[model samples]
Structure formats: C-alpha cells, structure tokens
Target: MIELRSLTKNFEDKKVLRGINSVFEGGKCNLIIGRSGSGKTVLMKCIVGLLTPTTGNVFYDERDFCVMTKRERTLLRREMGMIFQSAALFDSLTVLENVMFPLDMFSDQSYKERTRRAKYCLERVGLLDALSKSPGEISGGMQKRVAIARAIALEPKYLFCDEPNSGLDPKTSLVIDELIYSITQETGTTTIMNTHDMNSVLGIGDHILYLHEGEKEWEGTKDEVLGSTNERLSDFIFASDFLKKVKAAGAKS
Candidate 1:
C-alpha cells in the first residue's frame, strides 16, 4: 500500500498540491480523479518520485520515499511499474524489446531469460503474437497493451497509470481497465491511476480520490460516490450528460 501524508508540491511560488492525505490500498485500482488542473497530475508525479514535493512524505508500504537517497530511490524504483498518458513506447524497438528493456537494464537475467519473461508478459497482456511488431505498426489500443506488458515485465509490486485510457474508444478503454484490474488482483500490486475517465471510475475504481484545485476534496468507493453530498464532487462528476445517466441509473440500482 501507499500512504500520502500532508503531501504538498510547489512550482516557483504556485502550490499545486496542498497538504493532502490519503491511503492507496494494495491489490486494488486506486483512482485519482478531477477536472483539468485539479493537481491530480502533480500528486501522481510526487507519488511516483518524478517530482520533488516542497513538503510532505510519500510512504511505500510504510517507508517514507521522499527522503530516500538516489541509490535507495533507484532500488525502490525497481519495484515500480508505470504506464504513462501515452504508451511512450520506443518506436524503434520491437514489441518484445520494449517489454524486455527493464530487465535488460535492471536484471541480471541472460538474454534467453529476458526474452522468455518478456514473452510471458506479452502473452499476459494479449500481445503474444505482436512481439516482432513495431509500435508504429500497431493501433493506439495495441500500443497501450504493449506499454502495459512492458510495465509488468519485471513483475512489479506497484503499478501507476496516468490517463491510461486517453485517445482510445470506449470498448478499448474498458479492455485496458479490465486488464489493469486483473493484473492488480494477480500481482497484488498497489495500483494508482490518474484519469478523468468516469467510465473507468465506475468500472475499476476500488478507491477514488477527488481533487479540487490542489486539495483532496473527497475520497470514497464507487458506490459511496453516488450518494456524496459534496457539491463539488457531485457537479464535477455528474455535470456531463453521459455521467448524469450513469449516476441516475446508479441511484435506481
């Protein structure tokens, strides 16, 4: 599990995150959701150690990650897997190579061992036959799958996804969502996803963190979210016609 304690991030003089506290349980899809510029992205970056927070601590399985030395952090990173907003695959490399990149850089595994593990990871993501394919030769959804395969190649204990469903059709998005959910269950990874996709919120958001202009406005499960009395959350989530129908149906259900 991951814990955020009074987490705060600043840029120049502007504060993006403001003393937020939350618990991201392991073996579940913990979602950070908000409107654009709600500081959700900043919070994710801090949790992933990509950005240094001005104040506060990020604890991974109870250890404070904010103060770790470079080597300590690098070792910690070995346990982490990340899928970015874009698949961010190395286009020049084959799908298998992309998945094997982590092991190549971090593991003592031989070429044959890396290839075997990478192939297994690809199969897990339903990309078994695409090993030799380049990123540019595939569709957006397929590229996302490759990214996921790469993320899990090392069998990481934690998974972080940023806007994972961006630029995909609804069906593809749901597939990716289900894949992540299944992976979390299989690996017991502490999964944190940053997204504005409400469909994803209902589909796999075991824990939801709602951010409002840099503050943690509310936190709850999917079922609890429908009954929220917090106007900001209600408006932010139920504002769209699509979400309105979903929530209305949720109310009836």
Candidate 2:
C-alpha cells in the first residue's frame, strides 16, 4: 500500500500539484485520471520518486520515502516495476532477452535460473511463442505484452503503469487492461496507473483519483463515477460522443 500526506509540487512559480492526500491499496488497480494539464503525470512522478514533492510525505507500506538515503532509495527501487507509455523495449534484444534484463542486472540468481524465470513471465503473458522475436517484428499490442512481461519478471511488490493502453485498438486496449488487473490481483502488488483512457477508468479502476487544475477534485470507485454529481467529473466523463451516446441509450433502455 502507498499513502500520500498533503502532497504538493511546484515548478519554479507554477504549482503542479496541490495539497493532495490519498491511499492506494494493494491487490487493486489504483488509477489517476484527468485532463491533459490536470497534473496526473506530475502526481505519479512524485509518488515514484522521479520528482520531489515540495511539502509532504510519501510512504511505501508505511516507510517514509522522502527521508530515505540514496542507497536506501536505490534498494527500494529494486522492489518496484514500471511500464512506460511506450512499450520501451530495446529493438536490438529478443523478447525473452528483454524480460531477462532485470534479472541479469539485479538478481543474484544463476543464468539458468534467470532464463527459467524469464520464460515463466513470458508464458504468463501468453507470449512464449514470441520469445526470439525483436520488438520491431511484433505488433504494438504484442510489444506492450512484452513490456508487461519484462515489468513483472522481477516479481515486484509494486507496479506502476503510465498509459499502458496507449496507441492500441479498443480490443487490444481491453486486453492490456485485463492483463494488468489480473496481474495485480494475482501478485497482490500495489498497482498505480496514470491514464486518460476512459475505457480503462471503467474497466479496471478499483480506485480512481480525479485531478483538476493541480488539485484533487474527486476520488471514488468506478461504480460511483456515473452516479457522481460533481459537475466537472460529469463533464469529463461524457466529453466523448461515444460515451454520451451510451449514456443516452442507457437512459432509453
């Protein structure tokens, strides 16, 4: 689990995050969503130690992250896994090699053990057949699956995904969403994702944080989102014509 206490971030004179407080529970998909300039990305960065908070505390399973020493923070990072907006796989490496990269860099396991672990992760993602293929040879969705396999190869206690469903068809997006949700439940990892995809919001958002103009405007579960009377949230939710049409169809039914 992760907890934020009065978190805030400022960029020179522009404030990116206000005094936000929230709890991200483990074994669930905690999502951060908002408009392009609403600061969701900044908030995720602060929580992951990529950016420093101006005034507040970030705790990982009750350990204060702000006060940790450099070595301590480095060690703590080994327990966390990250998936970028892009698949971020190396074109020069095979899919299996990409998954094995973390194990080779950090794990004390023997080469055979690392190979076994990498293959297992690939199998879990249903990509064992793509083991020898390079990133350039696969489709976007397959590349994303490889990225997921690599992220989980270390069996991390926490997982962070930034737009994991970006740049994919709706069908592929749903596949990625279900994969992340299942992985979180299976491993009991504290999973936090920064995304603007509304499909993802309703699909696997166990906990949702809505930011508006650098402030936490609302927070709730996916089931409560449609019933919310918050004007801004309602506007944001129905902004797309597809969703508006769905709402109208539901009302008619």
Candidate 3:
C-alpha cells in the first residue's frame, strides 16, 4: 500500500499540492480524481517518486522515499509499473518488442525466456493476435491494452495508471477499467489510477481521493461518495450533465 503524509509541492511560487494525506489500498483500484490543473497529476507524480515533495513524505510499503539515496530510489522504482496517459508505445516496435522492452532492460533472463514472458503478457491483455502489429496498426483501445501488457511485464508490486481510459468510448473505457481491476486482484498489486472520469470513479474505484485546487477535499469508497454531503464534492461530481441524468434516472426507479 502507498501512504501520503502531509504532502506538499509547488511549481515556482505556485502551490500545486497542499498537505495531502491518504492511503491507497493494496490489491484494489485506488483512484485520484480532479479537474485539469487541479494538482491531480502532481500528486500522482509525487506518489510514484517521479516528483519530490517540497515539504512532506511518501511512504511506499513503509519506506519513506524522501530520505532514500538516488541509487536507492532507482532500485525502489524498479518495483513500480507505470501506464502512461497515451499508452506511450514505441511506433517502430512490434507488440511483442514493446512488451519485451522492460524485461530486457531490467531482467537477466535469456532471450527465449523473455519472448515467452512477453507473449504471456500480450495474451493476458487479450492481444495475442497483434504480436507483430506496430502501434499504428491498432486502435486506441488496443494500444491501451498493449500498454497494460508492457506495464505488467515487470510484475511490479505497485501499478500506476494515468488516465487509463482517456480517449476510448464508454464501452472501451469500461473494458480497460475492468482489465486493470482484474489484473490488480489477480496479482495483488497496489493499483492507483489518476482520472477525471466519474464513470471510472463509480465503476472501479475501490478507494477514491478527491482534489480541489491542490488540496484533498474528500475521500471514501464509491458508496460513500454518492451520499457525501460535501458541497464542493457535490458540485464537482454532479456538475456533469451526464451524471445528473444518471442520478435522475436512478431516482425514478
């Protein structure tokens, strides 16, 4: 599990995250949600050790990241699996190569072993047929799946996803969300997703942290979120016309 204690960050003179504290559970989909420019990305970056907090600590499995030496931190980072916002696949590499990249970089395993492992990851993400396909040959959803295969190739203890369903339709979004959730449960990986999508928040969020202008405004499970009385949270959550429509429909039933 990941824990934050009095976390704070600033870009130049502007504060981006302010004394944020929350625990993201292991083996579940823990989500960080906020509008654009609301410090969500900063907080995620800090949690993953990509960004250093100016005045706080991030504890990953009880080890404080701030006090670690550079080499120590790099070693710690090897335990992390990150899925970027764009899937970030290499255009020149085939699906198999893309999945093999991490294993090659980090593992002492043989080529044959690497190929076998990468292929297994591809099949796990439901992309066995696309092994030889380049990134351009696949749809956005397929590309996202390929990215997932690569992310988990390392078999990390912690998995971080930045907008896992960013550009997909609702159906595809749900598919990706479910895939991430299933993988987390199967691997017992600590999964943390940064997203602004409410559908994701309601569907796969086992733990949710809401941020507003660089501060955590509220946090809870999906059920608690729906019945929350926090006005800012209500405005931010129900602000979506689509969410209001869903609420209206639910009320009628």
Alpha carbon lDDT of each predicted model = 0.93, 0.93, 0.92
Q: Please write out the lDDT profile of model 2 over residues 1-253, one tens digit for every residue.
A: 9999999999999999999999999999999999999998889899999999999999999999999999999999998998888889988899999999999999999999999999999998899999999999999999989999999999999999988888899999998999999999999999999888899999899999999998999999999888789999989988999998988898798
TM-score for predicted model 2 compared with the true structure: 0.97
Give lDDT: candidate 3, residue 80.
90
Local accuracy of candidate 3 as per-residue lDDT tens digits, 1-47: 89999999998999999999998879989999888898988998898
Worst 10 residues of 2 by lDDT: 244-253
Off by over 4 Å in 2: none
Residue 222, candidate 2: Cα error in Å is: 0.6
TM-score to native of every candidate shown: 0.96, 0.97, 0.96
Report the C-alpha lDDT of model 1 over 1-253, residue by residue, as the tens digit: 9999999998988989999999999999999999999998889999999899899999999888998999999999999999998899998899999999999999899999999999999998899998898999999999999999999989999999999999999999999999999999988999999988888988898999999999999999987887899999999889899879987897788
Could you tell me which residue pairs clash in candidate 2?
none
Query: What RMSD does each model have against the real structure?
Result: 1.3, 1.2, 1.3
Question: Which sections of candidate 1 miss by over 4 Å?
Answer: 249-253
Cα error, candidate 3, residue 150 (Å): 0.5
In each prediction, how many residue pairs overlap at the backbone (N, C-alpha, C within less than 3 A)? 0, 0, 0
Give the per-residue Cα lDDT of candidate 3 at 119: 96
